[model samples]
Target: MSTTEIKRIKSKVKTNSKYVSLITWIVMIYFVFSVVMLIRAAFLPEEAFTATPGLIFWQITIPINAGFSFNINIPMEVLPNYEPERFQAKAAFITYHSIYLLTYTSVLLYGIRQLTYILWSITDGHTPFTINNSVRLRNIAFAAIGNALLAGHIATICISIFVTQIFSMNILNISFSGLIIGSLLLVISQIFRYGAYLQEQYDTTL
Candidate 1:
């Protein structure tokens, strides 16, 4: 290769290394934030945060992008003042919550596995690697799928929580909290993905 080409390659490698380092740092920060939130939840009373089991699940698995705004307009009469109707509604809520939780747990586990694979591929250095290029692509695909799953799950959970809040006539501050958290999660996810892309580009040039 020409001297100019060699310099360009070196520059790309340097850029990629920087990106990887930045992304790794961001992930560690996010994990620390999660730990802090978990600790707060453990210490605080139920009234402090008011995140239901499903909401907790959503918070735990930000990879799925599972937080979304939802409209909840329920008429008073339709809810039925009768005890039996209320009981039925409660039962339905329980069932829905159970199914979503189970699905999310499975998706979360898979997502973690995918993340590990991606991290492994990125960290693998100049050694004679046995794994083909397809492995990296496969890991990215798996991570994307996991993100999709989490998005759906988070949306469902957010909608449910919104509805419950409205039904209870609670304050509106929780929506803002969700919005802030969701935005942060999205940025972090993008950063990690972009870092990976830069790493791949740098590797290809080498």
Candidate 2:
């Protein structure tokens, strides 16, 4: 790309990174609030249910389609049926959800941070086709792919210990989208690495 085009792209990425940063902060706040809710439910299930009277935090694992479950809302009257009477079940549910949330959010945050760094480098007039950028993209791809493939399984295993008793756990979210996107990112990273090699060769010749 011409220098002018590259500059324009960098400028755009810089502006967009600010918006991404804001979204990351919002998600962080949401994660904190979700953790707090789970903790309250673990200790005081009744109190937590009272706060969100109509909704219950449980999942049905029978996927309606490949890797995705039905999202139909349950009747508010049915909420009482799902509530676990025993504290152990409630605590197990909390633990299951907490681990999954922590894993998913951590991956998301790390990917965004790396992306911001790449954008900042471009904005600072560093070439986008650098070895460092290639590595960052590959890292992001792996992290996302790992989360997509294993987060649900890990959370399910944690909750499965209390399988005899029904636990109020969110549905296992095995996302095909993450897997696809990660694979695409990995390919893009390889392309970037090749571009970096070419860039280095050009510089050496100059």
Candidate 3:
């Protein structure tokens, strides 16, 4: 690409970095807010939990053709008539929510930190393709993969708890988008490493 194009791309990356930084701060604040809210909910009066059912209705469907399918909605309200258990279930729900939020926020912040480093490197007038940047990219890629796995594990655990403990049901859903994106980033990191090697050779010839 031409110098102008590279400059434009760098400018864009820099701008996006600012946005990412803003989001990072916002997420941090929101995380703290959520923790506080969870604490408050945990301490809420028993009467405040009068409306929750310790159960979830899962709709399952299996497609046999383009338009034909079998469907079932399992409504498991095990503690429907038990007020104390329902209140306890609400507390458990808050606990799970808090745990999920903590894990998610931690992973998000770490990824954002890696991204911020890349953006800073791009805008620092240094050669964009360097060994350090390549490593940072690789780190971010691996972090993405780890984040996805951790999230899926946490979700599975929480779902299991809700299903078995609260409603005696069972279900699972896991997303692989992070793994896909991380694979792409891993490829990009290899490209950056190669670019850094070439840049080093060129500098040596000079």
Candidate 4:
């Protein structure tokens, strides 16, 4: 790549990468806050928990603004029946949510981190066609696929246990976007790998 092109790529990515980094930080902070709150909420007084008529879950809400609010739900606990066993179920349900939060956040941060690195690589005196970039893209693609496959299975299993033992229902969920995008990215990663190989040949010829 030419000096001017490299400079341009660096300039563009510097701004975008900074924004992505900011978002990552925000997500981290939110996750920590959520974990602490989820734990505390689990053991809250009965008054803190509410169940609407005909609703299948209990919820607690904390006001953020006049119109904004933070809400947490306890699953598998039907309305008007605050059985003691529901407390244990609440703890288990909270664990599933915590796992979901951590998993989602980890995938999000890692994928964007790799993307940021890929963007800035050109700035560091390296061409866009590099094996490192292909590997990073591949990592992101696999992460996406794994996340898609694992998507609702965790929560479904968690909730399904209660549903089967207590209630009766069917559950099914899938992340089509993740599957499609991940598959496309896998192809793109291979293309990038081939491009890097060709770039190596060109450099060697020079």
Candidate 5:
């Protein structure tokens, strides 16, 4: 090919890559907006947690269990039906909310890391799933592990709440169960870290 032809080919490749990157950025922005809306709509309102059975699940349950009160904790002035057990339930609610807060932090961290990977991949003009572009994929996998750990936290909280509130399980048993789950999560996360390191080495060699 002539010199001019070669230059035009390279220019086209760069242009296409930039276009793809722009689309990626737009999609990521939409994703972030959706996530924020979901959290607000599903969990933040008063009616969500105190619904029919008074049991909110998943991400919504996290804040409820964690005890972040954005006007949701206001007590009814008139106790419609006074019961000692009802007061105990309210105390339990507070404890659950506190636990949820800790777990929610993990989720938010993982989510931010995931978005970082997406942005980096787009800006670098790197394909997310190619051997020649393995570094970006490795970053994505690390983010996945973060997400997995956060998911595990949610699961442990849910199981504990179910055992304690629904089935009246013992506290010691619940604590032990959570410990085991957390340990497994650490092990899984380490494995992902190792894989990411290996991919980084491979990329450097290339």
Candidate 6:
């Protein structure tokens, strides 16, 4: 691409990044609110614990000469029972979810902060292919992967806890999209690394 085209792309990136940074801040605030709500819900009286079970439903359709679709709903008791042992179980569950939420939000905020930094660098007229930019991109890739893995681990623990103490059902959920996005980010980070190396060589030659 020509220099003019590159400049135009950078300008767009900077604008979009500013908007995304704003959204990230908004989400962070919402997360804090959610944490407060979770704590409040956990401490409510036994009579106030009128919560129901959570259900996971999935449907898949195949289109071909012979097409078939099936829907399945799996229900798991997410709310704590008011019994002594069950109430203890509920407290443990709440603690686990709180930790997971905080950790997940922290990872996302770090990634967003790195993205904001990169955007600011572009807006400040710094070349996009700098060593710092490459490092930031790599951190983002790791954060994405970490978030996905952490989510899966937390889900598994949740399922295990509920199944053993509250219900007798199986639940498994993992975000394939998150894995794909993380992989793509990792690839892009490598590209950025190469670009930074080339930029360094160019600067040295000049």
RMSD, each candidate, Å? 12.9, 8.5, 10.0, 4.7, 11.6, 10.1
Q: Can you tell me which runs of candidate 2 are displaced by over 4 Å?
A: 1-3, 45-89, 162-173
Clashes of each: 5, 0, 0, 0, 6, 0
Model 4: residues with Cα > 4 Å off, grouped in runs: 51-69, 72-89, 162-172
Off by over 4 Å in 1: 50-131, 154-206
Top-down TM-score ranking = 4, 2, 6, 3, 1, 5
Model 3 lDDT per residue over 82-171, tens place = 444433544444645555576667777887888788788889877878999899889888878876666655544554465335433222
Candidate 3 TM-score, C-alpha based: 0.69
Candidate 2 local accuracy as lDDT?
0.67
User: What's the TM-score of each model vs. the native?
Assistant: 0.39, 0.72, 0.69, 0.75, 0.31, 0.70
Model 2, range 53-83, lDDT digits (tens) per residue?
2344444222234664322222222222433
By lDDT, rank the candidates, best first. 4, 2, 3, 6, 5, 1
lDDT of each: 0.41, 0.67, 0.65, 0.68, 0.42, 0.62
As a whole number from 0 to 100, the lDDT of residue 185 in candidate 6 is 88
RMSD score of candidate 3 (Å): 10.0
Candidate 1 TM-score to native: 0.39
Q: Give the higher-TM-score candidate: 3 or 4.
A: 4
The TM-score measured for candidate 6 stands at 0.70
Q: What pairs collide in candidate 2? A: none
Compared with the true structure, what per-residue lDDT tens digits does model 4 show for residues 1-206?
A: 79787678778877887888888789879888788767775666545433332266555464445776566554443222455445443444355567667667788878988987886776566777899999999999999988877755655555546423444333435578998999999999999999999999989994
